[model samples]
Target: MTILLMLVQIIVLFVLVMLHVAYATYFERKIIGHMQVRLGPMQVGWHGLLQPIADGIKSFFKEDIIPEQADRPTFMAAPIICLVAMMTSLAVLPFAKGWVLADINIGLLFIFAMSSLASYGVVLAGWASNSKFSFLGGLRSMAQVISYEIAMGLSLVGVMLMSGSLNLTQIVEAQGNSILGMYLLPQCIGFFVFFISMLAETNRVPFDLPEAETELVSGYCTEYSGMRYAIFFMAEYIGMMVMAAIGTVCFLGGWNGPFAVPFFPPLWFLLKIYLFMFIFIWIRATLPRYRYDQLMDLGWKLLIPLALVNIVVTACLKAMIG
Candidate 1:
């Protein structure tokens, strides 16, 4: 019975996440459109509310085009690998009090591992495509992820040290149920580094060198089309949401708000994720992509060092308090 219940929960979570992934695209288009003083997607069902549904249907029906010289097996598997890894990370996220798919002790580490694994899909897609542009994009993604992943992991060391647990739920509980109890106050430097690293990790604007169309013709997944392409798209949005959720859980105090919604426990948690999502979209609309050299320099020379310093400081604080 317990196993059956878990299976049901997993299916529901998958459905909800996929729906969120679909609508995230619509939301980004609308937000960016209004940012640029335009009405976005007005033609698709009531101010573009149904646009995501249309997109999913269109992607499903489109021809699955494979490059003539592409490695068939790896090319086919790459997007699935990316999508599956991102989706798996969703299982460990604490949506609200007592509301998590997997409340394991090493949930945080598991997410990091899954994120690292997602980069392999990008690299494999690039290599398997047998296209120069795709190869370059894949190489770029590999290097970018390697650099930023370090910074991102280090940035959260402070959170783990302070909370004294690797479990996501425990981290939230350690913060207490108050707006003032959030780690955002003491870990400002770590948060700054983490935010920048998060942008680079997800390949968002100002750091989106991996798929710079102007340079690499759509980067790693350039040869992909139709449903496979949609899967990659879905994976990226899911990655964004997952990173945002981690930030909310670690720094912003997950589900902690001034008032509670009786009917919805995760409302505050969802709101924090939205807040992070809004900033992500806002950055995309505002900033231009960084040069490859600049991106590398920012990650290694700046963000990583900042993250290390944050760790040292956090350690000192922890020792003194103890």
Candidate 2:
């Protein structure tokens, strides 16, 4: 019975996240449209309010096409792998005071591990497609993820050290007595590194070299079509949400706000996540894509060193105060 309950919870969470994944794209389109001073998606349902639902139906009906030379088994598995890994990390993130799927002690480590695992889907999608463009996109994504992952981990080390706990909820609790309500002020450097790295992590604009439409013709997913292709995109948007959620936990003070909502307490949490999501969309609308070499330089030359320095400074301050 207990195992069945867990399975049911997992299914519920998965469906909820997938729904969010669908709506995120619709919102992105609507937001970007308004940003460019154009009406976005007015045709579907009530100014395209139900556009994502329409899209899901269309995707479900679309024919699944497999390339002649593509590795059938691997190609099919890649998107599933991506989606599973992306969702697994959400288990440990606390939504409200007691609302979380998995409140594991080593939640932070689990997230990093799941993140590393998620990259395999990208790499396999490229290699299995048997296309040079896909292969290149896979390689670029792998390299970019590896480089930024190092810096992102290092930046979070400061938070981990200060809180003395790997659990995200504990980290938030630690911030209650902090200089500010959040780690954003003291860990500004880490926050900056995290923000930039997260954009790269999600393959968003300015760092989206892996999926450049003009260059790689949709990058690693050029060969995919129908629901298989849609799954890849779903993974991408879900990834963006995961990163935003993690950012809220690490820096923005998870579920901690000036005023609490009268109804569900997680409103503060959702609001912060929404703010990050909006900033993500705002960036996509406002910024131009960065050149590949420039992207590499920004990650390795700039963000990595900054993260390291933040760690050192944080450790020294902690020692002195102790």
Candidate 3:
């Protein structure tokens, strides 16, 4: 019965996540469309509500093309690797009390490990495509992911220190009694660094050098088509969701709400996630992509040191208070 319940939960979360991904694309287009004073996907369903479904169908029936010079097996495996890594990370996120798929002690570490694994998909996809543009994009992506990932992980170390545990649930609980009841207040610098790193981690605008369409013609997925391309898209959205979830869990007090609203912790969590998603879209619409060199410099010279200092300051403050 426990196993059945776990399986059911997994399936339900999977469906919800897939739906979220589909709608996220629609949401992005709608938001960006309105921002640019144009209608987006008005012909599909009501206000283009069904556009994601239409796109899914189109992708399914599209021809799967393998480039003559491409490494067929790795090219195919890359997207699968990307999708699986993102999906697996969701298992450890606690939506609310007793609502996690896996209440692992090392939940935070698991998420970091999974996110790091996701970069392999882009790297392999670019390498296996055997295109100069794709290869260059892949190299850029690897460097970016590796650079930002260090700061991203370090930023969270402050939370782990304050909470005195690696479990995500405990981290949330720890925030309930902290100053301002959220890690964001005390770890503001870390939060800022992590938030920017999240943008880079998900390959969102302002940091989307890897797939700069104008420059690299879709980057790592240049040679991909049909369902393969769909998988890449799916992985991208899932990564966005995962990053939002992490932001909620680490900084904004995951599922934490006022005592007056204790009955609906999940609502607060969802609200925070949606807000982050909106920020993601808003930035995508507003910011220009950063030059690759500028991006690398920001990640290494600025964010990383800020994250380290935030961790040090947080630890000192916690010890002083204790």
Clashing residue pairs for model 1: none
List per-prediction Cα lDDT, in the order shown: 0.94, 0.90, 0.91
Worst 10 residues of 3 by lDDT: 256-265
Q: Model 2 reaches what TM-score against the true structure?
A: 0.97
Q: Write the per-residue lDDT of candidate 2 for residues 250-286, one digit (tens) a residue.
A: 9989998897777798888888998999999999999
Candidate 2 weakest lDDT stretch, 10 residues? 172-181
Instruction: Sort the predicted structures by lDDT, highest score first.
Output: 1, 3, 2
Give the per-residue lDDT digits (tens) of candidate 1, residues 234-305. 999999999999999999999877787898999999999989999999999999889999899999999988
Write down the TM-score for model 3.
0.97
Off by more than 4 A, model 1: 177-179
The candidate, 1 or 3, that scores higher on lDDT is 1
Candidate number achieving the greatest TM-score relative to the actual structure: 1
| TM-score result, candidate 1 | 0.98
Compose the digit string of candidate 3's lDDT tens values, residues 112-168.
999989999999999999999999999999999999999899988887888888898
| Candidate 1 residue-pair clash tally | 0
